[model samples]
Structure formats: structure tokens, C-alpha cells
Target: MTKPQKAIIIGAGPAGLAAALRLQQYNHISSVVYEIRPKPTTLGGAIGIPSNGLRLLHRLGLYDNIRLRAAETSNLVLHAIKGDVIGKADLTSWSRDKTGFGYLRIQRTSLMDVFYDAARLADIPIHFGKRLVGIVENSDGVTATFDDNTSDTADFLLGCDGIHSAVRKLYVDPNMTPEYSGVVNIFSLLETIMLPQARLSLDGLNATLTTDGLLALCPCTATNEMIYWFFSRQLSMPPGGGGRDGWEEKGKQEVENLKVTLLELLKDTSGEWGDMWKAIINQTNVVKFYPIFRMVLGGQWARGRCLILGDAAHAMQPHASQGVSMALEDVFLLSKLLEIPGRSLEEVYAVYEQKRRPRTDRMSKMAERNGNVRKKTGPWQLWLQECAISGMMSVYNLCRLDRLGIGQKELAYDVEEEEV
Candidate 1:
């Protein structure tokens, strides 16, 4: 019998937990997880899980659970800044038959709960509050040291840490860092009764292109009594603003300032439609603020037996909503490569990069375009955007003509099927 393989994983977020779950399936693969955070957080807003990610989650026995806690949207309806409907992208029926799953929108915390539960059931050890500060690799394998003064040696290490990955900086490339996306995304939760217009607009994912930024709203809970919404806009980094460069969450005073800034921008909006959106911000109790960031797309993912995945490997602009999905895909693909025989750890790492980089590069570019489009638009630019969207969605609703893969291509990202 072959000896067991030992693996060390950093960051107990979605990527690390998913890696632990997949590796537990093979008795020969023994893995351990370490997280930087003190404990599990129910923070963050809703995330959209695409079909490619859904497929892997299903195989990991997570899809059914995710569906139970998730809300399904039929389509993403687009509206102009002035509250006129422009287009709709089919979300439910178009690709269900082909992919065996539709898009899922769920809170990030809910999904993390599921992953943590599965890891516990599998008896996988996850040490929280253990931050990775250093990594050392040799021909024998890799040794990872945590802030707690604990160290572990494994056949190889997988850096599932987030965008500010310690493993990547200490091992892969110390010079590489995540660049601020210049957009701060603010999300809030509100009762369905807070805005009647939003309740009526909650038929699906409602995305509006405004002069200030892009605002998106969706019903996340099953009862449809609560709505999750977010808005993205640019912010300038003040010189010597004392940690205003977008790292830590702001204090109570700063939060109030954010609300004031937002209200000032939307103060001009006047009407029932405007009130609905403004009320969403004014009446909310909890607001999540995030300064988006992205990494250089084309870079080395592996060096010797150490490699990175998830946000550590590629941090695309959140405009595409594929950051988590890409990480989910990476862990599953790595597990599949582990099944291949006669391949050294380094060899598998190379194949992992070979299989994944092309897709990440494409997403990186698409996210850039999408992010630019969502930025503050001029009069002519907003008009052109609305017209283009109206035309494409009109055609898709009429003839199901999705040359840009609106409903078809996105919901069916089966790389193996494509190869066949």
C-alpha cells in the first residue's frame, strides 16, 4: 500500500474548508487547516454561486444543503437610472437542463457554516486564530510556521489564504500585492416592509445603472421578507488619512461619515423610485463596507512544492462575482489531479496552474471591463449602456440568442465536456 500524503492548508475560509473536505475522501491524503481569524464570522453579503461551482459543491455533498439555505432567482432584470426596465437575463430555465443546477444566491456566512460543519463531521482538524507568518520548502516537502509558534511539515502546502496571502508573499512572490480596485462596495440588509417598491422589484436580481454607481438588489432569505442590496462607487485615498487605504473596517464615527457621504450623493434623487433606493440605505441598521482589490492576473502560482489557490492565486474584481466560485473550482481541480499516479507534488502543481490560469486570466479581463462599466458614468455613456443592454436582452427574451453566453455559456462552464 502507498504511504499517506500530508498537506498543510492556510486560511479556513471557503477555499481551505473545501480543500479539507475533498482531501478527506481519499484515505491516503491527510490534511490540516489553519485560519487567521479568531473565529467564524457571519459577516459579508450574499454571493452568487455559478454553475461550475455548483457542480463541484454538489459532488462535495454541499449543493443540497446550500439549496436549502439559498434563494433562487429567475432572472436578473436590468433597469435604467431613471427606473425604467431595460433588459432581463434569464437565470433559471435556460441552463438548468444542461448543468443540473441553477444559480444560487446565499449569504457568505451560511455557506461557511455548511463547510465548517462538513469539516467537523469528516474529523478534519482546523485550528483557528492561527495565522501563517512563514513557509519553508525543501526537497523532502514543505514546513509551515504559524504565529502561535507551531509548525508542521507536509508533503506539500496549499495556500488557500485570501488576497493578502502570507504564503504567496513569503513564498511565491514577495513583491506581488493586491492593488486597490478604487471602488468601495457597501451592502445592507432591510426588512421587506422598509420599501414596498423594492418588494415589487424583488422579482429577481435587480441591477440599476445610476449616475453615481451601480446598485444591485436581491431577496436573500427564503421567506422573501428581507432584501440584500449593494452599491459600488469610487473613493479617493486621502493622503495620511490614518489607515484609510482600505484595510480594516472603520469605527462608528467613520461609519456615520460613510452614510452621510452616500446620502449627499443620492440627495438629488426625487420620486417614489428614488425614495425606495434611498430608504434602503437610510433605514438599514447593518452596513458592510469593502474596498475592492485585484491582483496581477498573470503570475506564477507555484514554486517548488508550495502553491496557492482561491483569492491568493487570483483576486479578480468583484464585479464578476466569480472570486469565490473560482476558489471553489480550484480546490476541486486540485483534488482530481491528486488522483493521477506517478506525478510528483511539483508536477501536479504545474498541471494545476496549466489547467486553471487561462480561465482566471479571462475572468480577470472580464472583471476589469465590468468594473469600468459600473464606475460613475457620463450622460452619453449611461445612455449608450442602457441602449446596448436593452437590445441584447430584448433579443435574448425573443429568440434566446445569447451569443455572449448570457444564460447559456455562463451556466454551463464544463471544461471537461468542452474538451470532449
Candidate 2:
């Protein structure tokens, strides 16, 4: 097999940045990250990097760098919207023992800054405002045509371009897309006085579910007085279906139509949760509505000399908060496989898809199922959750599902083995 000299990474988000950094370190792989979003530094949202993710950050020498900029969350508290203490679990103890670290709650922009700075330190060039227009791959390599009509070629092209990936469309089939889970994630961050009723420690996070839907309140690691809430409800799927491919083309009016519809669903919770809902809604901050959808992959994640990573391959619901973590996992696994001794690109890609696809697929299914159990109107389900909560001391413990593969042997590049 030929040595990996150059590669092209689409999207400068966490996954792409991690891949570029690791590949550069091990394979001395020169790369360029093409991102359509300009001013990537300004992108902001609350993102929780679990202990598993923290371990990877440590490997890249950015763990402490991120720790200084982010808040460490001990648990995810679960409560009844009606003000009843339901289930709680101590996530810090469970995961800390397993991975030697805890969860870090940081803004999306903050996390990106850490990754981007590390890439810069490693001298990885990131090309912003470059939209991919076309992709042509042959037996030897792949070429990417950008919206500016400029083109670049490399040994392989990695598509980390999120759910709506042009590279996926060009190399893979056009029909495979992320479908709506009948949910709209309405989230906002705002300054608020630390009220006594707020169950989350000014330092912790909460996942409160009612007969209405799910409301998650978590403190911002960057700001103590501010809190982030992700409010969502299940919606009925439209006829003929809605998905990532057809989502943007659905038009503002159609999307707006759905937003108004989701707003109406929140009506049931309006008169129930004190003025908490009012305070959140009336705050002088920006609120954004995102359509929640899960991607169902068709065929495989790689084709010929092209491969897709992150949301491009498997866009899962955010229930388990594993979206970015799984993407990080891809960085670890794929990069290690590529560094293998005498392995062809095709063989490495095949191994990566085989190892990762099942895990991500299982996680996606869990998110969908959990969404159903979290619906507020379900009496039996709520009762079951409440019973489980009582058996635990913290909200984190109550909501702890089967601890998945955390101690899986870390996949690292073995230079001695590869060289021999």
C-alpha cells in the first residue's frame, strides 16, 4: 500500500479537525479542511463532551486546554415538571472510575476554538467559505470541485460536512438522508438569577420531563449566571416524509409552518411550570429552532476512494448526547486503521465502517426509543421512570442506561509495528 501523503477533509468541525490533527501526527498526512461556514469561531451552542470524549482530547493534548475553558458537569438531574424529585444518578463517579475524567459542558464555539487552535498549532490549514460543488474519484485518488469553481485533489476525500453533505450525494446515492424524528429542538441560553427552585446546582445540569415533553436545563460552563435549555416535543411526520436532503429545499415558509406547529405543542406546558416558561420565552436573547432528524444510512459509509464521517454518515438524534462523541470515536478508529502497516485505503475504510457502523446504529435506535419514553403524557412510562429515580441518589444515576463500551482498548498508532 502507498503511504498517505495528502488528504482532503470537508468540514472544519470537531471530527474533521481531530482527524486532520491525528493523521498529521502519525502518518504525517498533509490536509486541508474546507468549510462552507465563514466565521467559524462565532458558532455557539452548549455541547457536552463525555468522559470518553475527554480521553480523546487528552490524547490530542487539548484536555487541559478545554478544561480551562469549560465547566465540568457531575451529573444530569432528572425531575418531574410538576416539581417532584424523580430519578438521580452520580455520573461523575461512574464515568470517572471508567475513563479517569468527567463530562465537560462547554459552548459549541468554545469547543471549536480548542480544536481549531490545536489544528493551527499542528500547522493544519483550514479553508473556510469553500462550498463543495462537485466530487470526482478514480482508482488512484479523488478531486473536489468547490463552489468557486476551484478544484483540489488528494489521496482520499473525507466528508465530515454534517447531515447535508454534498460529498455524500456525489459519491454515495442521493436518496439516503436524515429523517425527522417528529421533534423540534428549541434551545436558548440566557442570563437568570439563580433561583432556589432550580434543581441543578449552579454548576450542574438537569433533564426535566413532564407530561408535555422534555426540558433540559444545564448551566453554562463559561458563565455562572446563565443557563441553557433544550425544549423539544415529538411531532407527526408529514406525508411523503421530510429529511436532510429535502429539508433546506422545503423553504422558509414550510419550515416556519413547522415552527409554529411546535410552538403550539408547548401550549400544554405553559400554564403548568410556574412562570419559568414565561421567563425563558420573554428573555432578551436569541432563540433558534432546529428540526431533529435521524439519518438512516444506505449501503455503506465508504465508496471507492471517498469516505463519509460524522453526521454525513449517521446523523443520530441527540437524546443520548452521543452525536459529537461518536464522531470523535470515528476520528480515533479511522485514523488508527489508516496508520496500520501495509493496509490499503479500501481495506482500512472497510474495517472502520464495520467496527463503527453497528455501534452508531445501536445508539441511534436508543435515542429514538428514549424519545418515546420521555413523552410527558405517558402515565405508565412516567411512573416507571419515577420508580427508577427513587432508587438512585442523583438524577444522573436514575437516567444511567447500560454503560456501553467505554474500556474498549484505545486504538492508537503503533509506529514500531507499522515500520516493521
Best candidate, lDDT-wise?
A: 1
TM-score of each: 0.90, 0.83
Error of 2 at 38 (Å): 2.9
lDDT of each: 0.77, 0.70
lDDT of 1 by residue, 1-420 (tens): 133388899988888888888887843587899888888875578887767778778878989888888777657888776666778776646566677887777888888988998999988998889878788877777899988899999987888888889988999877777887777688877777878564674676887776668888887766667678887776654345426543453434345676666566555555555677777876887887777778986777898878898999898888877777788778877877777777777777788888888888888888787887657777778789889989977877788665445646655676443220
Q: 1-420 in candidate 2: lDDT tens per residue?
A: 888789999998887898899888867889989998875863356887776678778877889888887766766556564544455555555557667877777778778888988988888989899989888878778899998988899998899888878878877656687676777676777665734444233346766665556777676665455677776766555445754445444434444564444345444443324345545555525666677777985556787777888888998888766777778778878777887789888898888877787777877887787677545466567656667656644433344442432222222211122221
Summing lDDT over every window of 10 consecutive residues in candidate 1, give the lowest-scoring window. Answer: 245-254
Error of 2 at 359 (Å): 1.4
Which stretches in model 1 have alpha-carbon errors above 4 Å?
A: 1-4, 26-28, 197-201, 240-272, 403-407, 415-420
Query: Worst lDDT window (10 residues) for model 2?
Result: 411-420
Which numbered prediction scores highest in TM-score against the true structure?
Answer: 1
lDDT of 1: 0.77
